[model samples]
Target: EGLRKAKSRLMEPLMQVDITTPEEYMGDILGDINGRRGMVGDLGERGNIKTISAQVPLANMFQYVSTLRSMSKGRANYSMKLANYDFVPPNVEEELKKGFVLETEED
Candidate 1:
């Protein structure tokens, strides 16, 4: 029964993210990610600051660092890793469908 319960893990599209920001700007960073439909995996305090780990859709990641910098007053830094592709959040999916167009290269 235990094995059966743990047998499968559904894989979804994700971008592994680690963001570090000054304590005062934590709220802004979190709020920004929330708007992007990011899933917060962890949040912890480090000395006088905070770290946030999350999985966000690649589609929502365009210019993410720049956006964060503006919100955090240039005090935030983050690292991202390509996780895996999976279903996008409904809101993100909707936005992508509505306005995100891909430009093809000419051969």
Candidate 2:
């Protein structure tokens, strides 16, 4: 197909995320964010609470509310909005392409 002959890449949305949590949970929160492929940005504190800012892919944020609640013992809060789109990692792109091919072949 013409599409296959052309150069194309898969992209995914990235989000700007800010999280506020008790100081005690800072380490756990940071670890979790990193594990989710988030790039940590700013860190700040207010009283016993800490604030963390990061950019994370939207795909990694599904059901994040539940994860945050459990990790922070219901004490952390976060907000995220779409920041931009970036190319998917090569491995993920390959998997997506394989799935797409399977779906098209079944039709």
Candidate 3:
């Protein structure tokens, strides 16, 4: 009833994020992105920092700000905005299932 109606009407947008960090941290960053089921759309260089463009799920991105801060030791900065829906990979789905835990929002 209500759940079905909400699911049918609820909407969210995809965001494109660009991060700048040291070259040495590329693998670590990419690994984290992959683990989060994110897709690496592009990579480039700008001065001393490596620029990485990735498409990440909005639901999973909630904790990204803090995580990136800790991972880069304050050397990284990112910007994101709405994009479009894309298919999530099979492996990512499996990983999410394994990591999923049943918890109530109120709890």
Candidate 4:
């Protein structure tokens, strides 16, 4: 029981993200980040490039590079650094467990 409890308390990964794109693509980029459960942090620029800073859960960011590239027509560039590991949200944990059960049942 103690082992199960400890396993359930595992940490989740979080990332610090910085995305740069042309001005024309700002709206689409912002909308995409919001849809991915990301929180907008700061907005800045390096010369003509507009940059968005956000922190997003690592799980939710899978395939993000492909999606971002498609959306930007290869014009956007982004980077992420693993910022910390934190507790998984209850809902996310439940969903992950459900997925595991579903996979087992399928097999």
Candidate 5:
């Protein structure tokens, strides 16, 4: 099937994201990022806000906007763009293999 051919080629997209929040919130934010299989590429502080830049897989980033908003209590802001795809880590791939069954987009 055409889908099989695409899978054989193994194409995916990477994304770069910028997140801003108070310095006190960095630990919670960093934990969430790591939970989503993201790597922090850079981090810095500007006045009262901490800025973090990261690269994450597109698949793992789905519905991330709402999740971030809820986690930060609407105090955080984020932006992201497509970068390039890279192979997923073996552990993450194994976990995803268990399958994701979502009842709705909100899930």
Candidate 6:
């Protein structure tokens, strides 16, 4: 009852993602990150490899190893850690709520 009266928002975990890939694969990697609702933070370099830093939602990172391998032909590598929690966008929240089911026990 209290929850109904108060304002609330769905929150999701965001991850700080750091990727290292060859120059040739930079565009593909960046596109993929954008598709996952990621925000690119920095662009840097280490020797011949290019480095990308971005923040992406944890939900979109499942099975990312295979995707990265295919995109970069096993050349790119990435690591991620919990960055923070943020409120879900209205559209995404509505979609999530559609699949949610509530169960109650009979008294």
> How well does candidate 5 score on lDDT at residue 81?
98
* Model 2 spans with C-alpha error above 4 angstroms: none
Model 5, range 1-107, lDDT digits (tens) per residue?
46445664344588998999977778988998888778899999889899999987788898988888888888899999998888776666545544532333347
Cα lDDT over the full model 5:
0.81
For each candidate, what is the lDDT? 0.79, 0.92, 0.77, 0.88, 0.81, 0.91
**Candidate 3 residue-wise lDDT, 1-107, digit = tens:** 46545643333356798889998888888998887767899999988889999988787788888988888887888898877876555665555545543333335
Weakest lDDT window of 10 consecutive positions for candidate 6: 98-107
Q: Distance from true position, residue 75, model 3, in Å?
A: 0.5
| lDDT, residue 51, candidate 3 | 95
lDDT tens per residue, model 6, 1-107: 35436866789999999999999999999999999999999999999999999999999999999999999999999999999999998999877765552322222
Instruction: Find the candidate with the highest TM-score and give its number.
Output: 2
Candidate 2: count the clashes.
0
Go through the candidates in order and give the C-alpha RMSD of each one to the true structure: 9.0, 1.3, 5.4, 2.6, 5.8, 2.7
Which digits, one per residue and each the tens of the lDDT, describe model 1 over residues 1-107?
A: 35337753333467899999999998888888887778899999889889999988776789998998898889989999998777655665555445533422221
User: What is the alpha-carbon RMSD of candidate 6 to the true structure?
Assistant: 2.7
Sort by TM-score, top down from the best: 2, 6, 4, 5, 1, 3
Estimate candidate 2's RMSD in Å: 1.3
What TM-score fits each model? Answer: 0.71, 0.90, 0.69, 0.79, 0.74, 0.89
Candidate number achieving the greatest lDDT relative to the actual structure: 2
Supply candidate 1's per-residue lDDT for 80: 94
Off by over 4 Å in 4: 1-8, 101-107
Better of 2 and 4 by lDDT: 2
Between prediction 3 and prediction 4, the one with superior lDDT is 4
